[model samples]
Target: MSMSFGKSLAGSVLALAAASAAQADVPQVATDIAPVHGLVARVMDGLGEPALVVQPGASPHSYSMRPSEARALEQSDAVFWIGAELEPWLEESIDTLASDALVVELLGVDGITTLEFREGATFEAHDHEHGDEPHADHDHDHASEEHAAHDHADETAHDDHDHADEASHEGEKHDGHDHGDEEHDHEGEDHAGHDHAGHSHEGVDPHAWLDPENAKTWLDVIAEDLAELDPENAETYRANATAGREEIDAAMADVETMLSTADDVSFVVFHDAYHYFENRFGISAAGAISLSDATDPSPARVEEVRDTIRDLGVACVFAEPQFNQDLVATVSDGTDVQAAVIDPLGFELEMGPDFYPELIRSIGDSIASCTSSS
Candidate 1:
């Protein structure tokens, strides 16, 4: 064969190998939850499917990472999680396990407004008392109660001051920096490379996805990030996200319409996780049975909730899949209040590109079930 012909053949082979290498560089994405996976899945449609870390029926709050899941994280090009507040177990693991992977916390993304746990929600903030204050002249017990109230008021004021100061500092930081940078901190001040540490989990609700608007914000961010990572699929990602937003908007409209007719709808949930959902849709929950599925309320607290149920004439007592149903039964034992199961985590539902809309609809359905009764 001619030397010139041999050289041309070698060049062709090298070009084909380079093309394969470029395709390999397309990111292998990983997400922490089913709904997040659902969002990412839509953005990556026709490009590739993302790996899900937490599977259906598992609780992200208390889930232990498995060996295979760790390996998936290590192999991923980018990892998307809600935030450390929702999945605290991932806080240490993602840093250690996926050290090289690009980690994006969805809650930290701009345009997504976060909700706080209701002021009087069952997850009461730890009351750190200030120094004792002098009480007015009164009976011993009355004076003590007044002093305690004063201390609480003082603590609340101090917390408010600290939070305001932190917000000012955060605003200054953002004025000179990019919004989506992992290092710039989304929740007030930076936490020295730990974004989660910057925000207090006590009052900040981590279930931001429950709000359709937040989900729309998420789609925009997801498409932007995915396009940056995979330029070849930029149009596809953006187009899919746009379509997803439209679907969410339409579904949310329907949800609002469906639940609009219920009169005096009052209920209780298994935990404080649904504040985002309840607040976004203009639904009011009486309270939660517990702060979290991992923590059980005391007998006295349980009795108090029962009294609340009786007094308020609650329509339904909603239970979750991760926790036991016995508590729900006990809460509604002799009452006419209906006991309904609402799976916030989509425990029994199928996970895919459609999971997000379906999950939202399920929540609407559960609320409608009891509210429509009376």
Candidate 2:
């Protein structure tokens, strides 16, 4: 029988439970992608380094579990994923995983304001061609803030995800989406802590962690979960999360500053992964060539983006380091869209094994310099 993601996850928890001090290697953990892995590594604080199923320069949008990655998850103490919608591949099977292994959906981590995953929100879509649904939380806030001015759009305007604004003009606007995917089931919690089994809401964007602040939440949750899993090293997990958050806090400021006042407020890109990045600093791009990680741009999308770029006079159309370069070159080439590479995964940077911080900062610097060079 084929092992499911949940079964693999359960086996991972067991393996991790058995990882006593006698073990030579670090505690075992598995992440869905480089960013989450980097955050996990930070929270783990060298006690056990986590591995990512998705390597750097890879698109998390279309990523699937490979045998090697699945086996790795089986050996993990905990498995960290972005969220159900972000990584739908892990959804059904993740439940089957052993209860011992911790499954973290970072975007659902508390204390962060998540955005709506709706049509014409920020970039385009990759995985969801079916339709744009509303998260109960985001949808509420959007409606509450229905009268909110364009202030939300100031910095993260295009990426702020105040779909409520879009809602009004959209025949109906809504706000305050809180999928809270990371809410700890706290054992005694409702449904007998079954909420910890998975996510609560849907259509809330999972890439919120791509924002440095959101990533800090992931680190915090990782540390908290680690402490829960290994009370002996709870302090260690806390310390690591604290350090990681500090780094992230500082890095977020830098990203904010880098994006605060762009030389060219309007730019373009191949993919829409930079919503967090763009929102942090208030920079607005014309639009993205690619909508989601799993999907490609259609001919209509291409023309629409082309027209937008031309109208907006965007200088740069950033391309991701891991995706197929052909689309970017094919459509963006020769146009005013100067294609540049952006590393959302922190793919190539070897900032120690602690590359997550370095990854965000590096990307910040890249965006900062992109238009300013002119």
Candidate 3:
């Protein structure tokens, strides 16, 4: 009896050691934003959790990394981000800190659909084709060079601001039409650098995660990357990703059903960040108050948006949680337009595999509730 008990105890110890070894073998992954972190969390469900670089309620456009976040990057086995277009601030940090880590730029991923930046405060209807191939102008290599050029241009523009200001005043008095053209030219020249806040909006819109299809595509990419690092769990990673894709599809279908009640309802967003979600669901915003979230719309642009609301009889103006609510209030003050809050970042949601789908559903709910009432 004593001999049998000793053998059983030895078997239990061996099993525990093997389990601990497998756990230790899991890779340390890091992601830039909540949505990406949620997706990676889904893919790495059983293996490990990826560290989130940009925390909730913080704007990615102008975020400073905490020491803990920097350390997370330093210790990461792999780091994933949307690329310099979305987070130029992170580019240098990643190069400096996570030099040994495998970096995956999601914007440069193959089979992703990218949309060009729509100019001006109000957007015209876009008829641009969505293709599997990345746009030539937005090729990863070209984008990096363009980003570098924008940096140099920003310095030059800063130095020549006074000269440009004088030129503007002189041109304004000469002819209103010529002045308008000159102003447009100046804005175009600086658009990629700083005019629309700090974002590099010269080429593709970097909010691709808003599109469920892109999210699905990214799941496979995440799985493949994780598999490459830990081949022993390749099947598990791929399976988890496949499961994540199905969850997104199911959530998308539910969202479609929820939004069906508000098909004819017109709306405007705080910024032009929802094109991917809009285009995916066959709905479009009448106009955006700002070109991007980080930009503050000029008075003229705000007036134009007010005109849009009055003319289109827009049902709702969606405000973001991270932005000032006063802007939405100003836009909706005189009109019967219902002001509703929509969060693109899922700030309030608990971060996990389910967060992405919940974020999409919440937006749908916010829009549907307000528009249906209107």
Indicate which candidate wins on TM-score. 3
Per-residue lDDT tens digits for candidate 1, residues 1-374, read 99999999999999999887866766888899988998888777766788988767656655556677888888987888887656665766777777766677776555566654442233223111311111112212221122212111111222311222111111112213321222223344232211233233344567778878888877876787677768887888899999899888887987888788653677888876776776577666777776542344545556666877888888888988766568888888789998888978777677677778888888888889777874
Whole-model lDDT values for every prediction: 0.66, 0.58, 0.73
Error of 3 at 145 (Å): 24
Would you estimate the TM-scores of all the predictions?
Answer: 0.72, 0.69, 0.80
Model 1 residue 264 lDDT score: 63
Q: Predict model 1's lDDT versus the native.
A: 0.66
Residue 249 lDDT, candidate 2, scale 0-100: 77
State the weakest 10-residue window (summed lDDT) of model 2. Answer: 165-174
lDDT, residue 313, model 2: 67
Q: Write the per-residue lDDT of candidate 2 for residues 1-374, one digit (tens) a residue.
A: 55698899999888877775424434577778777777887777667677767655545554445677777777766777776556554544454542345566566555565655423312334224533232222222211221212111112222222211110011111122222221212232223211112222234656676667677666666676666667778888889888988988787777777766574566776666666665555555556665544244445566676776666666776777655567666666557656678777776786334677788878778777777753
- The global Cα lDDT (0 to 1) of model 2 is 0.58
lDDT, model 3, position 115: 73
Stretches of candidate 3 exceeding 4 Å from the true structure: 1-6, 125-200
